[model samples]
Target: MTQTKRRWRVSPATIAPVLIISWAVTSAIATGFNFRPLVLLELQTQALFFRLRGEVAPPPELVILAIDDDSLTRGRDAKELKELASIRSWPWRRTAYAEAIDKIMAAGARSVAVDVLWDLPSERPADDQRLQQTLKRYAGRVTLAAIHATSESIGGGLDQLVYPDPMFQVDPKAIGLINYSPEPDGQLRRFASVYLNQIDADLRQSKSDLLSFDEASLQTSKLPFNAPKGDYIFFYGGSNTFAIVPFWTVLYPQNWERLKQEQIFKDKIVLIGPTAAFLQDIHPTPFGDLSGIEVHANAIATLLEDRAIAEVMPDPAWRGFYLFLALAGIGLAIGQVSKRTTPRFVLAIVIAGGWWLVGYASFVYGGLILPVAAPFLAISLSGLFYLSTGAANDQLEKLRLRRTLERYVAKPIVKEILSQPEDFQALLQGRKLNAAVLFCDIRGFTTLSYKLPPETLVSLLNTYLNAMVEAVAAASGTIDKFIGDAVMAEFGSPVSYGEETDAMNAIRAALGMRQALAALRSQWQQEGKTLLYHGIGISYGEVIAGNIGSLRRLEYTVIGDTVNVASRVEGLTKSFWTDILITDALYQRVQEHVEVVFVGEHLLRGREDSPSRLYSLIGLKGEAPTLYHQVHEELRRYLGYIEATES
Candidate 1:
């Protein structure tokens, strides 16, 4: 025989699923590439980012010098002058500041930037000249500190004390206006960088008369010391200025001799700022409390090491393109893979989790922010779209299954089947779950229907069917199907479990159904309705449980010889004068668990040679022994006869 090749036929519905999946997952893949959150975090973290990024800043050359409390106190103790009232008459006196100043000069220091301001004439004029004399001697090397603000009101003090020296002239080589004015919070976030030097350095050039500049002759001849690199670390509240040199260090004999000789004043740059009471110049910085000189030291370090703690974000035009491209790509990936219905949800969860990991890693290690909000948005939107379609198709499959179950089983049974979605799917895939099945039918439905109008017969049948289904449901037995007027049920079907399980549950559900039917039958008789008795048959065995049909159609039902045998056993209820008949296999399992009367053997369908013994399940526990024993003896005798005959 020649084999025929199968061709796939596509319909609008068929292609619709594929298209939807493509569109959905594509949105997810596109959203991930936009790294925007880098800007959202705190600035300190941003500072850390640059620190870790290793971007270098150009070095700046500057230093600080401060006049402190010891000078003032020593002058006072010597009775040099009587406070601010007698400015000119104050007698001069030398203190620790003068001694340290001499040592710093001997240290090969480059430039001394004095950040101290002489707001007023010192209480001791003689003592003040000694300090000014020290500044004047190194006038070429010293950069005098002055208060440069919109208010130049507090003047003359520095000019008179330092600038008015008769022994030496104020060197034009000195830099002027050294204070780094900060914002009210004193946060040195931005470099004082570019603007202030125009005013301050301009003033210094004009006053100092220092020149390397060509007037109108040679087009260019500017001085070498002109360019000021703005890179400087701001140490707000520590000893960057005064060197603290501790009052105690100066008092030490070894250091005192060096201080007197001005040995600390070599080529090193010296910074001086407050580190004592009365002269408060402290502020908080990264490494803790610092003073102005310490700030200068930090600034010097930053410049030297080429360190910048901030990043200027890329322009909007590029940012927009990046975001758009990332989102678009993610969307494409999501849409492409979404066609696999069942796995789509699993894939979405995996995508979301994986994206988080990547984003976190990028942020922590690479100092780069991944576009999480957008990418996640795309994934979620795409996943939701894919999910909706999947759910719709799933529901459609469910409806098909319910229709099939309805044909064979009752409403309650159909509802029970629907309750567990996984179980229902397993049924479609053919899983033998632990479930209880009940098979029921009218006692003389065939004969009774023959005598009555067909319409009236169906009505009566529907009533009994309704009652029996309710009885099985009440006992937790799932009605598998109804063949003509006969019903089939089982102990376990939908859920598969260990061996001893389905047997006991099946017996319980069967016993409960018997009780339920008994009451229903009695009520029907009392009402004068077309009275009918029902026979129930139950079996416990592995069977394929699932939706049975093509893609266009499907039905959830159980199939196997166990289910067939249960039906055959139910059919034999007529041969024996009994309302309920169960096989020996079922009886052996539930014997010790429920109250059942073993009926004598009967020829079960599909088993002509061997007669199967039947049982009437009454209820649970030790309720009715006499009835049970009688039925048991009859079953024993009949089964013995069959066994002997078979041998």
Candidate 2:
């Protein structure tokens, strides 16, 4: 009976649920456990988005009056300007701020916010009076900086609220806290319009609010503030994003004329603070380290322009968005109708790229923030799962094939076939190649069956065929088929070790079968059971070898003249009164390794015209003499007697 080949295929429907479940479980774990890595990855991706957006133009209404390094150096070095000489070094007199504010207000500025904190009265009483009077003059127009300090006592909290001195407190609403909230990574990305002093029982209980400096500045300017309660600031750019006019320049007569001519401060909210590195007010941002004044200006600009970035994922309604994204990406990667890995990988990459594009576009155009790292990780994990499953399935299929192939061929041949699976698959379709075919048949099976009962006859046949198969397998020969008491095998068809080697292996297998049968006969004789003898024929030639028959029922065997000749030679063994026979073609290949005697040339059973040369295989050249050597002597004497009789 012909055997059919089975194929294994992976269904996408079966894999889809696994991928979905894996994604859901992973997302749940990440969300429930609050995976910090994913959060940090999200922040980094957001920073990347900022970098990709590059520098944006800040609002023209906002300007920074910076106390930079240049102004500080000139204040001490420019001895010609005796009025500015007193402004040298750290903590310049409050009189300079008083004068700068006067000049800025005189220039038709909308508002002036001093980022410096004058928490203590100046040593010069007259200078404090002068700064205090100036602040009161522009009472509601000026916003002074304050701080929320954490108490060193147990349970550190915002227990201390440092405000400008009482003398400088012109408008109560003009004092706002300058405290910035940095994320876990020490990067400043968020701003709050108003902070509730939760640490102070009275303030928390009374529901009084503490405003940020940016909020106070906007309120003092009388500009519309439309920012959310707390949101991520849409930074205009990195450092120097806003226009900067040095403090000394604003206060000097020569520079004041230049500034007034250009209308630098006109209708603009001027933020006065230290921009020099020595002042130590720098903080890390998405773009880079920026001075505190620039951060405040960016925050104020965000509120004034209503460009706060709102996170959509934090909303409960949108929580499923990540799951959907992960599924879509995984599906694009592995849920394909075709099971090719390259296309799936390419599709996965496209999905990731497209997601990044959408995220960036949404951030740039819609002022919204979408998740980046978590979804990407989900997609990557899903792809890895798919690939690992595919690899495992492939291994299982190979094992199945190997087991199936081993049924027909020996373990060594099966290993060869599996090592180059594609090539072996092609060979199974059919190929014409040189190989050695062997056929072995019990000599007197028919007579033995007549003398014995049906059960004994079947048992004896099975025992004989098993020994023959073991011999073939030991020599790396493929067992083609078993026809009753006869066995057909081939060497070097599916996998070859060269023509000479195939011929030698076939010879070796035939000799091994002879020895196995000899032992069986001796055992049967001692047990007083029927003894059996067999003849083997080996032929080497080109033959068509492959799986033949209908698709549903196939047989992997060799066909053509080489197989036919081998069968004919096995039949000729009875005529010669010998056990083993080989064709001239096979003898030629294995002549050096095997000893053989020429048999008379004769036509095969099918062909009557052309006669073929045949030989009786004796023993291997290097091995000790065996039963075949005795058989060789008997065969020679018989041939001589037959020749004499015929003559």
Candidate 3:
């Protein structure tokens, strides 16, 4: 027997490590290299967390004094409201803001942060002095907005710091930078308490470290605020989450009684900034676009409520910890499970959903933000890897089975069995089918074995069996088994073309074996080796065909009177001096396609009363005349022996 070639197999032990390593490398690229797309994806997933959480109530202590279109346009045409009419257009007179501050302070507000920048003094000196005096009155309780301009030089460092006019800077702690730093994707999610700059003293003296407007307001309000140096702002909701009062409402005399009655600003931190569309103060947020004033309000509220979301550390060790958790999750999901695609896929989906739930719960209940995108991707990629490899493995397994089956069965039969596995499996369990069984054995094998050495005998037997197997295989017959020098084959088993086709193929295979034996005889005469001859007997009937034997060793073969009768018929070939014989059942099916002579009914060895009718197979009906003549002459040489046996 030829050795089968070794094939490469993908085992779980190999697949598991490869999956883990692939995940690790991908995570490293996402974290260590700061893969921009993945980072953006992570941001989007975090936004989903916010949506899942829905709207939350903001702190009542935070208020947004919006300088809206109503505040800017309502009093424009009101002739009785002369002060408001005079300040309808932007760059309103400083006295208008001064009056609003006095009213809010009198209303018992804790602190006020103005988000409007005041880098240059107004054209009217009296108006500037009026606002300056009001700011000095509540210096420690008020905060003014400033801005940092990036230099046009290389690296885009902070070039200059623009503060409120000198007259309006009543207290050093009153000035704070109102710069909003949005993420690369243009969403403002984080807040910085202080912004440090490197610049000369001449441009701005002793002001290298600037506080954010929200932080400055907290300090001025005397609130005990301690937070991370830099962190994410857990937004309460979208626009208008904080209570908003139009800027003009606080300054309008007609609303004064209502404001004082409502006490809307009582001990509250008020952020005053432009909120009108033309003001260009709209900024993107997790929930949606929010006015700058509302953004600051949310920031201050986050600090007051200690609702800052802390991110998992980004160090290698911390990232590895997260990766480990992801691998562990995937392993638990699919490890040691069946190699079925559906089950593995379902488990993977469950694992991903569970991880998302964990992340959302962490954010909602613990004020922590876990990495969602990278780990989720890891699970998905691993699932796809396993599914793809699993499919490949299935194909490989089928190939292995086909190769093994081909060793004993014909290639065509093996292919048919594999192609329709369900039907073949049913056949293996057992089935009754009309089929043709062929049994062929060497004539006088015992005498031949005695005359030759063991090696020569074995070689000659192998050559003869090889020729017999090829003939059967050519006729689409499965080589059932080989008993030493004999070959057993079956047609129309496991699969069938038709009854007539199977009978014709069996007769064709027997004739082919005779021709093969004649060629071997010529070859042996030239090689000075012993000649060999084979006798074939074919029977057609309903037989139980199936894989029969112990669990460890099973054989696909037929077991019935048909098989036994076929063997007994082959034993009579030598007695009758014939090469091929067939029972009447098979001859009736193939009689139109073959030429045969009826060999009168005779009781087989086991059947004492009932005898089987048989025929001597000569040649096919459509063969050349010369071929038929040659076969006729061959049978004529045995005529005398057959007549003498009858006598």
Candidate 4:
């Protein structure tokens, strides 16, 4: 195919590598960029395989309403709040808390837990009166926030949050504490399981000894925790308990809540925190940013239902390892497919896919926090490298072969030689080769050519010469060259191995040539075309053969006196009045292996210094066979006769 044709479509030569390259590049990207995207993918993967083999947290049951722009409308008019001097500076409107608390009292929810700070006493007398009235109406029904204790002893709890009102009219029996002293990390790593500290303080102040006095009322606290190991108790309800309802919802009558008689303030755990804008009581965590109330909810839900991400909190060393593995694994996977463009890209595919599979399996199933980066990139890049490199090398080999062979051989022959690279270089070698060398010349070319038109002579010569050269190569002989109508060939040089049967091969080849020309010669006679004629001499001898001439202009040929005599013998073919003739030396070489019929002895036409025996090669006998079996048998009889005569 031509280059233009190949350009228009994907060929076998190009399609394969292209596919492999695409795979590798994609694999490289997947493996290279390891960050939030990869983690999201991992989470999705976890969702696929994360089975609740142990206990599962109850599903989140609460809905959310962000204390967002919508909540501003319920509190106070933005314009009015800005105009009011004292409130413009204070974050919340004086009456806002009362309005929200009143809404909660009307909602009829099981319990209302206020995630607010009431550490300082009420400021506005009117606002305080309104709040106190609401508090009395919902007495013992609402759980209020305590100002967290910011004890310079580094202690901070519900005390610092909400200060106790002197007119605290809510029923003491219904009151509950909403306080959490959590970690700086914003994770509620530990907490007191029960309100024992409060029980202690409440007793110190009231001397009621509530822990013992509350035996009948103990069911109301309903602390579900059971461990006795530390002053702090760990209570994790199922994931269901961890639901984070929006703080803004507490102001909506439909979405708010009031304590039911059965709540732990009735029969449930109540958590509280600030979600109001000015409060900004939130921090970041692995689960994303969350409110302290939500964190408390998460802690309770964790203890109740025990759901968690299985973290293999690494030793310092493994932390580095985990990071490296994750990034490296992804880079390698993408690199693998990017490197190859072949249909057989299974290696890269299998390997990269395996890395991902392995990472997923270890993290999800095996519960091992492994490094996912390096292995993934290794497989991907390696595949890409292997394929791209392979294609480049293959193209190079073809070009080299094409350039090297074109210098000496014909295109078709060069193609044949290249078709078998294994044997091409070995085609030329120096060896003692016994071959039937054919040298043919026009019988009277000089006179005949003068008689015909130049064009006519040339055409005739081409016809005859073309016919001879075809015959030589067709018979497994190498065409050395064509000298006008005189053609030279070697049957066992550049190609040998049948030299033992050289004499027979030469005879059959010569006969084939003579027979092949009968029709052509007859047709030429009928057309008033000149009859073609030539002399062919075959000889067998050890000859030196290989390519000869300067490096720039070399020819494949055989040379020696054996070749000279072959030419000299051709000069005698016409003199002997035969179309074919060979030296006695060729016949002798095949002495016991073939049969030859003598055509009689003759003096060479060009150099008649000595006469030589000439013969025609006949076929061999299959049984009791030896080369020239008949001649050797006759010679044996003659040798006995000579022995008797000598005696």
C-alpha displacement of 515 in model 4, angstroms? 18
Output the lDDT of residue 356, model 2.
Answer: 76
Candidate 3 residues 155-183, lDDT tens each? 66656788888878876557777776677
Superposed by TM-score, candidate 4 places the C-alpha of residue 293 at a distance from the truth, in angstroms, of 5.3
Runs in model 1 deviating more than 4 A are 1-41, 44-103, 116-186, 194-243, 246-267, 275-289, 310-432, 442-501, 543-588, 591-647
When 2 and 3 are scored with TM-score, the better candidate is 3
- In model 1, the Cα lDDT at residue 557 comes to 73
**Candidate 3 ranges with C-alpha deviation above 4 Å:** 1-20, 151-158, 194-205, 320-325, 328-336, 407-647
Number of the top candidate by lDDT? 2
lDDT, candidate 3, equals 0.78
Q: Per-prediction TM-score, please?
A: 0.51, 0.66, 0.67, 0.37
RMSD of each: 12.6, 8.8, 8.6, 17.5
Give the per-residue lDDT of model 1 (tens digit) for 40-80. 33334433433443433223333334434654454445453
lDDT of 2 by residue, 334-382 (tens): 5564464445555655666776788888887788877656666665555
Using TM-score as the measure, name the better of candidate 2 and candidate 4: 2
- Backbone collision tally, model 3: 0
The clash count of every prediction, one per candidate, is 94, 0, 0, 98
